[model samples]
Target: MSAALQIGLVLFPKVTQLDFTGPLQVFSSVPGAKVHLIWKRIEPVASDSVLTLTPTTTFADCPQLDVICVPGGFGTDDMVNDAEMLDFLRQQAKAAKYVTSVCTGSLVLGAAGLLKGYRATTHWSAMDMLAPYGATPAKTRVCVDRNRITGGGVTAGIDFALTLVSILVDRPTAEMIQLRLEYNPVPPFNSGSPDTAPPEILALMQERIAPARQRRSEANGRAAARLGGDVAAG
Candidate 1:
């Protein structure tokens, strides 16, 4: 029999745990598929301010992977600007069968010169940052540009992962996993996002997230200058 498909999940401090865990659960449901916690080193790292997770592999020790998944959070602002981190992503993604991301993870890919001329999406609040990275920032929750797949916001990771399962294995398998996980979503409030949120709530969210956004935007500018490529958002 063939070896199990190896999937690597990138980890960094301050990353939204849900962005990693949501897709991790769905991917783990598949048969003969392995998921590894990847990071710059082997250690436990905390989420943007929430939970902590231990990484299984580092840049130098990890084996070749079939898929590489990047998750986003405030930490992405850091990763997107790290020359070493982005270079690693570019190398692994170039050889991987698929490269995927959730939330602002697409921004990391862009920094790696992977999203050129590819339509992609990220958290709506962070979409504007994509332009400088040479990607056409899309508004959709899920966007697939060739082998690169990206999702918007933290919750969108679930949907994107199910889609990936369908693409990599089979639709039947994907559906079965979805059923097993009870993937249905129900928001307590009518305002999970800017459009659905009341004006006051939207303003509040923006106010709260602005500092991180500013950092990400600055990192994007630095990355763009380093990469020297055209922005493609279509």
Candidate 2:
């Protein structure tokens, strides 16, 4: 029999719950899949939203996984240079078959030195930050560059995970999962993307996101500096 697919998602403080949870629902439903919510400790971790998620495994105890996923949120800024967290990611990514992230989580992977020379994407507000990591940032909802797949903003995780489902299993499996979730999206508003939103609304949104974007840009610069060599070169 084939071995069960071992998948792990990093659970950190201030994470956007849906970034990983949306994907969690899809991944956990996979047959013979072992999904773990990993953190430094098995504790209740707070998120940007109201929910607090509990971690299933501590970093020290997490088994080598086939996939390592990270989700992004306002909390990601602090984790950019978090030595312990970045070290854990670097270690897991070395042995994992796939290394992935959602939203600003790509910034985390870049911080871990995993996205060097890869094409990736992040939340629209933080997309440019990928450049310093020696990554080619794409302006899309989901980007799959080699084995390093990345999703855009918070809601993009489900789409990214579904894409991953197709890669890990097959199209049939992903289609079935999508059907089960009734995942057909019909967003009530066409303002999801900056290109589609009214100019005034887009400007206001950019204004609100500016501070975070600035912080992220600064953090990405530091991270790329730390990574040096290739990241700087790229």
Tens-place lDDT digits, model 1, residues 179-205: 999988887998977888999999988
| lDDT (10s digit) by residue, model 2, range 14-37 | 999999999999998788999999
lDDT of each: 0.88, 0.91
User: Which candidate's TM-score is highest?
Assistant: 2
Give me candidate 1's TM-score against the actual structure: 0.94
Number of clashes in every candidate structure? 6, 0
RMSD of each predicted structure: 2.9, 2.0
Model 2 spans with C-alpha error above 4 angstroms: 229-234
Worst 10 residues of 2 by lDDT: 225-234
Residue 35 CA displacement from its true place in model 1, Å: 0.6
